[model samples]
Target: MEQSSKKSALSEKDGVNQPQSLSNSSVEVIKQMRRKQPSAQELIDGILAKDKVALSRAITLVESTNPEHLEKANTIIQACLPHANKSIRIGITGVPGVGKSTFIEAFGKHITSLGRKVAVLAVDPSSTISHGSILGDKTRMEELVKDENAFIRPSASGETLGGVARKTRETIILCEACGFDTIIIETVGVGQSETAVHSMVDFFLLLKISGAGDELQGIKRGIMEMADAIVINKADGDNIAKAKLAKTEFNRALHLFPAKQSGWIPTAATCSSYTKEGIDTVWKTISDYFELVKTNHYFEEKRQNQNQFWMMETINEQLKSNFYNHPEIIKLLEENKKAVQNDEISPFAAAINLLGKYFKS
Candidate 1:
């Protein structure tokens, strides 16, 4: 009887443990079901409805390099193109330690308060050694991050010369499609990125600060010429006078540059992100510039030119990728590199040999 009782207790314990194991497995199955991918149409519908989750997912799809994801991303972009071009795209750039995040938070909040949906595509610097990104923009712009009407995405620069992600233009399209009235593309602020940002944006705003050397030294002369407006940030407390002086200097220097194609002169403004002063003036400046450009039809013309530029850029990128990725080229590249270093072969001859092998293969 004692033996039978012990056997019954063991069986009951096994039966109890079986359901617990099954329960744990059932929870995992539920999680997998929750993570199942959404279809393209669903993503489109959700994005059009201004669903932030869907918008983020759509941007991720656009950023993906996977072949299948790229195809789907292209389809999504094609579907969304008709709905885009409604937003005013702005590019904001400045050197490090110029308070770009604080200014953006203030600027973004001010815009959102006026019933405008804002989207920030902040490009973060990727480490050259690890190729990984800090992606800390969201943390820096806490107010904007918490705002219901704002969408902020931080992308790795991936060592692109322009300090922008390769997919920034596509990301802009997706953001516009999601009904954001204001789309801000924040570059990594390494100075070379201004031209790339200017090419895509309707207006380029250069954020500067007083006491940062000559205002021109803070930004390259080429970048200054490209700015639609120069905003001197941190213009509060004792720095107000210095900010005004910087603004004066910037204005005088801008007068020396040739006129813009839009025929509207670039202006300067002073703003204190801490005090939230001059933020509205900055917005008004952008609005007035857009109004003037739209009246002259330059806005449309610029976007058309951007499209052509992107097409050419894509073609060039593809050709380079194909050339460098060829198996024959890869096999010869290392050997030729060593030969060149040792003076066994001229660099020109090595190049020709590689090209010959590539073409034959």
Candidate 2:
């Protein structure tokens, strides 16, 4: 480098040029990585070829809130439609304290051991204040997370199940197209999350632990009716006897619920994620359900109905998003909310006022 020592303050000679921080080729590569999103056809082809990286990227696009990503994600879903619906979608839900992650890992590893590819879509609850989620399913399921035959994706349970469930449903399609034969959706088990998951899955499993006195007392009637199998998890050590008792109680409670349209009688089973005991029984139970449903043709019928439900849900989600995002409505919503909270206006009136302006504008 050369410098001008004898130069006027305002007329200093230009210093010799320094090398670029990055090469032109390196810059081009970085730009391509940042700016070039894979085409829908390219993502579809990659998914069909069972590429995990492509599957993850495609799922990310589906979950993205960006308008452009939404368009591409829809296109990719349409393309993968032909290959989807071939896998059994199972919904597993339990209360917050239940060992859902551990049970899922054990169950998933067992499924993969049987030479089947498994994909887990675990939904973590988001905090109301911060809207941030723990997203720790991958961390919790270390062994299953590392398995070559297993794929785990953790998604945040947003304000509602509408958008997140839709994304999860689409992710299922992508995973199926990528050759995953079994898809498991693990819900955060809050509010209506289980119901949303139940609508999409073929077999619904309600996981439980032996505690809190009567097991039947803790279960919701709707969940019991929806559940194809109620499996009591953590049936290891001193919990074995309690688990068996819970299983018996659950079986009796299951008998009280009316017969299902699928003509399948839900049963209560026990499984130990620690000892791997009765894990196979859970699979056998799931297999038995699929066999019966397929034989009775309820499997295809349910899929058709689920597709219709998905359409309605998508409509609801889009309308909700549009209403909340309206500039005119956005200005008035907080005013109405504060008015309602202060008893200046009834919630119904506030809602009507907001809805009226939203629709009018």
The candidate that achieves the highest TM-score relative to the unseen native structure? 1
Q: Per-candidate TM vs. native?
A: 0.89, 0.86
Candidate 1 residue-wise lDDT, 1-361, digit = tens = 3555445543544243333435887898999977998888998998889888998998888888787998889888889899999999999999888999999999999999999999999999999899898899999999899999999999999858867898899888888889898999998898788888888999999899998685759445678888889999999999999999999988888888889999999988899999999999999999999999999999999999999999998898777879988887888899999999999999999999988888887
lDDT of 1 at 85: 91
State the lDDT of candidate 2 residue by residue for 275-360, as single tens digits.
Answer: 99999999999999999999999999999999999899889989999999999988998888889889999999889888988888
TM-score (C-alpha, index-matched) for candidate 1: 0.89
Query: Would you give me the overall lDDT of model 1?
Result: 0.90
Q: Model 2: which ten-residue window has the lowest total lDDT?
A: 157-166
